[model samples]
Target: MVNESSVLFEKQGHIGILTLNRPPANAYHLEMLNCFNTSLRQAINDPEINAIIVDSSSEKFFCAGADIKVFEANTTEENAKMISQARENMALIENCEKVVIAVINGHCLGGGLEIALACDIRFAAKHQYLIGLPEINLGLIPGNGGSQRLTRLIGVSNAIQMLSTGDSISAQEAYRMGLINQLFDSEELMPAAVALASKLGQGPALAIAATKKAVYGGALLPMAEALELEKRLVDTLYDTQDGQEGFRAFVEKRPAQFTGK
Candidate 1:
């Protein structure tokens, strides 16, 4: 679907899966990012898809970050465009209406971790893999929404330490640090991630989208403003068909069949 490329997209029921397919390590460049963005847009535009998962085809390297070759012998204009594309891709993940989950079954470093951070949730394998923003080691820093999102997700001080040090931490440490939502056995990673996505996919899509908007968007505003935003979102949901269906189902002691209306 993407010129026989570095990413693959497939649908399973209500879930959309995007798999990084570059061999050895899914180190992405401009072309790969373009394909990845296009696939994500396809999922986002699909009305039938309620949840999406970002995964990989490799077992040893989730993604080794940007291909270093992109930085070699490239003009300033080309370099800027590359970084801009990476930033836009990250924003695409964060601003997507459908719930997104990143399943990290291998080492996730630098830009890879940044991509995971943009997702609503992350689950990693329990294998002895490392995860971090190791850009400092290369005498550069995360330019793909990593610095901003990482700080917001994991706190300023911790993010600063991790970025400044540019060192990869163990999967166990990443879990304890809240870098990942949970850790699964290597064999269970994708299945567990898919299980959660499937459950979410069955939920009321509009209300779930509203809640996600409230939490992520409201968190950026002041306290009073945030409360207002939440209240507004809740108020809107109450009038939706699914909301009424839920109420009637409860009164009738029957399961609600939401059509994501």
Candidate 2:
């Protein structure tokens, strides 16, 4: 296990586990945000880790968002710098070759929701949990990618309503809006997240990574261009060792063992 002042990084089999470890609310301070970025880079560079799961040590908060005290104390210049760093941190999560899953154990709002938005998938607990982009309530807007990402994930109408109203949604509502992939009982959340990560960890890593790249990269392109991009990615995957192994294993009537090469 690798421990930072604000986050805990550990590996379970082939899955890397990153737990947000700040106190009562798990709010992001500048130092915690920097530590989080460093921890994420460490996980990305670890060859043994195939997939990652981001969770929280807090029982009541996946993350309450930026620390109010810190925000209040910062000057305009300092706030700008912090916002830039937060965006960079989220970008790291988005661009990582390996899949990253956010396991939301409790409340997720504002910057917290933005963090989950960057992940490839999000799984949340069924009880005592709320998720939203509520920056409007603070007389500010989401400085992170919440505005863009939420609109892309759910649609502009829903995203506007959520962000403008500064209201939290229940787990069921979040799932319905496609903000979260799935929900589980509070007691079963972590185990379920681990199971899903393990399943992805054992898949053809090259193909999986390619799929992520194609989807996210193509989402903003024209339809014709997106299709072309998809074709290119698929062709690229065809040359991978795991690609050949997959076909061979199919013909041999055996499970494919992918080495991520």
Candidate 3:
């Protein structure tokens, strides 16, 4: 395990696990945010690690959002800088070649929900945990990517309702709204996430990365442009070793041993 201030990094097989380690609430402070981004870059650079899971060590709260005290003390300019930094980190997660999953073990609110939204997939605990963007309660709006990402994930009506009221939703409600990919009992959450990540890690890496790029990049374009983007990505994958290996394995009636080449 690698410890850096409030974040803990660990590798299990081909999956890199990042735990938000600040006790109780696991609120994001400037130092913790910096450590999170640095650790994420390290994980991304490690070729052996093909997938990542972001979770919290705290049992009661995945993350309570930013440290309230810090926000209260900072000037508008300072807060803007901090928000920009946070959004940059979120973009790193969104654009990662390998799949990144947010394993929400407990309460996920405000910036916490923003972080989860940035991930490619999210799995939450099924124990009635609260998850939402409650910045309105503080007489502020979501400073991170919450406004945009939330609307994209769920619909505008749902996003607006949640944001306007500052009301948190249950884990099941989040799943129903497509905010989270799946829900599991508290004890089963990490294991389930690891199992899913391990399967993806062992699959064709190049194809997986291309698919992610195609889906995310194409989502913002018109239908015709999106189809063209998909075609380009599919054509580009034909030159990859893993692509050939997958075809050969299918013909040979054997499991492909993907080396991520």
Candidate 4:
């Protein structure tokens, strides 16, 4: 019997792959959220894993959003717990040093889209794959980082329109809005995501972390403040062992071994 809980974790070479495995319309639940948190942490802690790709196992639905059944039967305490679980799960993805690429193969709705938004990059299948935050339909807004992240990804105006209207958009529209990084055919989605992750895995891990931090960390800051932060970050990297290795390797015309120190 398949588990109705949240996730399935697997490692492929240097890439850690996480699948949202709750099937027949994968919907979020507390157990699933906990599982995702545990799995993401495990992947992050593994030094051998240089990157992560979050994908779905089911054909029709990447995730159908939060488990409405849980909400339907919920007490106030239960609702609070569920919200907390989701927040933690999204934080796991967002704060992870290793780059995460969300492979949006099917229905990427509500909490599903929120989780995907936490990733460093997103690759989706063509137009038919629906994606949006529809929590407003249920008398709620996205409790995770959806509002903030979506605003950062697209823009405040587009984010407000999408979230407020509770309208699902095609993957093509998402890409056009600068919400998704790339588009792939349905048959090629997994391979494309894997290829992208593998490419990232082979690069300097520390540099990737620096890049992620500089962009996301500085997004809300003033231009001068962001520039200062970037300068400080680059200076920090300059004094590190990885910096030395990178320079020496460049001089020797060889690939640098990044210890992620």
After the best TM-score superposition of candidate 2, give how far the Cα of residue 75 lies from its true spot, in angstroms: 1.4
Error of 2 at 249 (Å): 0.6
Show pairs that collide, candidate 2: none
Question: Per-model C-alpha lDDT, please?
Answer: 0.89, 0.91, 0.91, 0.87
Residue range with the least summed lDDT across 10 consecutive positions in model 4? 1-10
Across 18-87, the per-residue lDDT of candidate 1 in tens digits comes to 9999988898888888889999998999999999999999989888888888777678898788789889
Residue-level lDDT for 31 in candidate 4: 83
Question: What C-alpha lDDT, on a 0 to 100 scale, does residue 109 get in candidate 3?
Answer: 94
Better-scoring candidate (TM-score), 2 or 4: 2
The segments of candidate 4 whose C-alpha lies over 4 angstroms from its true place after superposition are: 1-5
Q: What are the per-residue Cα lDDT tens digits for candidate 3 across 182-256?
A: 989889999999999999999888888988899999999999999999999899888688888989999999999
Per-candidate TM-score against the hidden true structure: 0.96, 0.98, 0.97, 0.94
**Candidate order by lDDT, highest to lowest?**
3, 2, 1, 4
Error of 4 at 130 (Å): 1.2
Instruction: Please give the TM-score that candidate 3 achieves against the real structure.
Output: 0.97
lDDT of 1: 0.89
